[model samples]
Target chain A: MIFSYELLAQAIVTGILIGGIFALISVGLSMIWGVMRIINFAHGEFLMIGMYIAYFLTAKAGWDPYLTIFITTPMLFLVGALIFQSTIRPILKDPSMNQIMLTLGLSLILQNLALVVFKADVLTSSTAYTRMNFMLGPVVVRGSQLIAFVGSALTAVFLYWFLQKTESGRAIRATAQNREAAALVGVNVRTTYLLAFGIGSATLGVAASLMIPFYYTSPTVGLFFGLIAYVVVVLGGLGNFIGALVAGLIIGLTESVGAAMLPGSLSRVLTYSLFVVVLLFRPQGIFGGKQQ
Target chain B: MLTVKDLKVQYGAFVALHGVSLSVTEGQVVSIVGANGAGKTTLINTISGLLRPTAGEISFEGRELARLESHTIASLGIVQVPEGRKLFPDMTVYENLLMGSYSKRAKQYRKESLEMVFHLFPRLEQRTKQLARTLSGGEQQMLAVGRAVMSKPRLMMFDEPSLGLAPLLVQSIFQTIRQLKEAGMTIMLVEQNVRQSLQISDYAYVLETGQIVLEGSGQAVLENEHTRKAYLGI
Candidate 1:
């Protein structure tokens, strides 16, 4: 195979745009894992739920995909809080195995519920700009992709601010770092857990809204993104917000570059291989996990 | 006032506290001194609602505390500077202090409490922007105590505050405790540094093998022959 600067540059640019979205998806998953001390197997299903919410508002009510973000963000946050208060909170002190089983079961229930209600249908949002494209030298940028990238980046920045500047956000980080100490300091650790989980799920809300313009959704759409999210999180290190962000970009870039270089769908294999190599060498993650 | 009467904390088959009783009145400093595995931490934990007592009564201001949750107890004004500091390693020193004032009771007084903490430990004031994990050992301990102060605790508890500090740092920590004592803050101290802890204590209890074997005014407890033989090495 031959290499050209134009081809490589174009792939890199496209990878970055998609990578931004990928990173955003993992941020919520990482935050939940960090603060709640649970894997949240239903994390991807939360994304699916967001997609459905966006789907209904856009395909049924004729709302713009981007405009639906306001609804999805808060709605998903509430969904996350309700799920946490009702189901997850009860089993919070149980062994990790039980928590894992509960979340895995939740994922199944959510998937089947979607299957029953929405049927085995692949739904795509037909927005006015879905097919729009732009040219920057040799790089062809899809308008939907650029919008998704920017939307994802802005949401990530907002979440970062909430974690850094707000009291609820500080409580979340404090709970993540040391639960016992957080409690002793008068931090309502349980409430912080609820908020952290909600914020985590809320990111998926924005993500689903952004992706629907370009991406298709189905009951099983979560399965693919779930795999990508876990890979990014592990590569970044568990409970590491900044690390997850970086890993998201790297995974995106690598996936695109590998696709351009390799034939067929072998690019996925490259992603997994990189994951394996990172796990073998730096199990704590690329950034070295936030040590207790 | 904080009071624990016949508190018996057992972990399944293992008994950690065997019917211990103690009390700290307002404006008084009480210390519980014991050797390793003497259930000192267990007693403090039960008082703070971190551990449940099989048979006991713990009350603060006449309100039952044994049945309450840990955070509820903290919010009610019984804050413990936990062993090993337990500082949020990832959070900044200021953020850690902010967390200390998270309860409704502490929120209003946070600004003044922070100023008081900075006055107590000027080193912590300088490192407000630094991560708690990055601080030196002594600085971390100071931050821990400073955070507890920010909680506006009615009865502050310390569990082995001087465990790993150097001799000089331990002396300074004791000095700070004395200062807080002078400020009319009621305190419950658990320490292995029996001599120093008792010196600052108004009343002291000697815990041995999950039981309180001796109790008296600080001077009397210090002068006890048994306490001297086993603890003081005098």
Candidate 2:
């Protein structure tokens, strides 16, 4: 219980690494929201499904969790697209309330389905690197967490390039800015919506694959992490990718440092309190300018 | 290159374009002059495939476009510089121009089209890095026109391009339209500025309450007693 500079440094390092993983999880949610303006309530369930996919691939098929990204990402992409076409598209012209209820319903269905299929038992992919850690001066960093951090950073870079540099990416941004204008310029707004949702779901696959090595998988596991992601997305501004990344780190640090300073039960309350303060002063978010 | 026959568009119980018919030949500037809520926007929107006609036909280059989506219509070379200068505000002027060539057919000629746009509006070239929202009203209109040109449109429609501009800027916009016509771009202009539009237009139509009341060569329509009295303030 003795306070030490080493403990504080370790907490900050671990928070940052964990924040990277959180960034990966929330970026997709941010993208879907940005392009389609749909707050996908089922986003957490998508991550949960990704975790289950990675779990099976590693535990049963003896595949490396990281390598399963190739399968999990595509599978989730299909799932995301299917969900969009079947449920979201029909009510697109309806009020925002309809969209919200539909996604919330989807979340519930996915959660219960996972409980039915994967059972209530908690599962983890105990890879060789799961328990491995390396000492960085006085701070020790877990190998799996470090890998997740690196993967999240790589995903962010790739996503940034994809949205900014590629033609389709530009189309997505244009659609996000103005759907009617995008259509006027011959950008297929509907297709862009599908692609955004698919990519958003796919990022969860990457997050899941990276996460299972160090974390447990359960039907409700996504709820906990997913709540943090919403906080991160809100803190970062709803639709800003880079903001989500920065906010993810902020949230991670807040949780870890807050837990160290206060009771664990009260740390989450502290995080929400920060979110409320942000909402009150800068509703557009810290990095969210007038633009997306 | 564009023709509409007996077009009737409705929004629920309200009829916007009541059996309106119009045509734009290749290499011509056709102006539709009307007061606000006189079905000018309805006709433009219908032609651009943003709104489907309740009854009638729209054919572009001899092909029917009644059932096509807006993007499909746009890809087939019928682009509209929508009302209010709907440029992607967050995007840079350069990026907005690039987005204009988003169609498959237009993509190949993007470089040349950009050069052409830059040549037409040197100010846009200078403000390439500036966001569309940051540009002045006149520059935004130029950027909107520039963005439409990027698509390499065969038939470019302008919806009140001179609306909400200073008188000087409006004159410049009309001058730009004339220059575009000189360069052989087909234009369909919808305007409230009857005299200026009639002066530059090859042919003109006068619409009132969702119906075309008069149609003729621009000079003939300009000199007509009814057009002069109702629209020209003579």
Candidate 3:
């Protein structure tokens, strides 16, 4: 096959658009990890929950996927807080093994429950913009991805402002940096934990809604997305927001470009290979040791 | 006013504070002098609601503090400039001070508090954007004190405020304490620097093995024979 500039441009555009979504997904995980110091294994399961909620809302209420975001994001927040109260908070001081087991077990339970109820068959919702496309010089961009990209940018901006400009946001960062110091400043550390986890889960709602127009939904759909999220967060340096954004884009470019050039599962091989190389060299992430 | 009666703290079977009592009247500089592991920090921490007292009564301005959490106690304007300068390591000096005003009552006075803190430590204003961890040891101590000041603290608790500073810095810190005292701030100081602490202190208590071995006016404790021989090396 001849190497064509058009194909490269196409892959780059596609990668960037999807990269925005990946960044959104990992930002939630980053906040949770930073404030709580818990690697939430069920992070992707919550995304799955978001997708399912969006799918059903579109199917049953004839709602657009975008409209479902208004419902799904807040719903996911409540879900995250409830789950924390029930499971994570009780065993917070327990050993790492207990936390891993409980979170992994929670993930398995969510997946199987969805499988039992939704029957594992793939589902998708079609909006008017689903199959639309826009041609720009040498590359064509999907309308759905453009919208998702816009949504991702807006969400990121809001999150950045929230963390920087608000009292609660300052409390979260202080708690993340030094828990005892945060208490000295009169921050309710436990409440901050709950808020961080809830906001983290809520981010998945926005991502799921954006993807529903172009992506399929199933209990197992989160498998690859979750794996990608883990890579993005690790590459961004755990708990670092800007790191996740840049790393997410890097992963998106690798996956899309690899898929365009290589066939079958070889694309994932490329992504994981990059992950390994990154881990071996600059494991602190793409930003080195820079703090947010 | 803050008062503790028969305060007892145990770490598992180990008794850290064995039935101690102390009091700080409003606008008075009260120092708790003790040797290392003599329960200075334990007593201060217990007052700040960090540790549950096994058996005790702590009242602050007529309110019970034994059932409150550390953050709640902090919100009541009982802030502590903790030992070792526990600043938020990754945050900027400005941000750390901003966090000190997170409580509602302190939040309203954020502007004035920032001004007051800056007045107390002009060096902190010079390095406002630098991260707390990057500051020199003395600067970190000043930032710690500045942060507590930003909380609009009605009662400031100092736990070894001069623990890890240079001799020069120690003089500067005690000087700052003297300034706060002039401003009529109530303080509870825990220190091993017996001479300097007692010099600025209005009232003082000497703790030995978690018990109050001596309690009197600062001049009285400073002039005592045991303090001079054991702590002051006179």
Q: Find the candidate with the highest TM-score and give its number.
A: 2
In the range B1-234, model 2's lDDT, one tens digit per residue, is 888999999999998989999999999999999999999998998888889889999999889999999999999999999999888998899899999999999999999999999899999989999999999889999999999999999999999998999999999999999989999999999999999999999999999999999999999999999998998788
Indicate the TM-score of model 1: 0.97
Off by over 4 Å in 3: none
| Chain A (alone) TM-scores for all candidate structures | 0.96, 0.97, 0.98
User: What TM-score, computed on C-alpha atoms, does each candidate reach?
Assistant: 0.97, 0.98, 0.98
> What does the lDDT read for residue A246 in candidate 2?
93
True contacts kept of each: 0.87, 0.83, 0.81
lDDT of 3 by residue, A86-151 (tens): 999998889989998999899899999999999989998887879889899989989999999999
The numbered model that scores best in DockQ is: 2
Task: Please estimate how well model 2 matches the true structure, expressed as its whole-model Cα lDDT.
Answer: 0.92
Q: Per-residue error at A209 for model 1, in Å?
A: 0.6
Off by over 4 Å in 2: none
DockQ of each: 0.71, 0.87, 0.80
**To one decimal place, how large is model 1's interface RMSD in Å?**
2.1
**Would candidate 3 be rated incorrect, acceptable, medium or high by CAPRI criteria?**
high
Model 1 scores a C-alpha lDDT of: 0.91
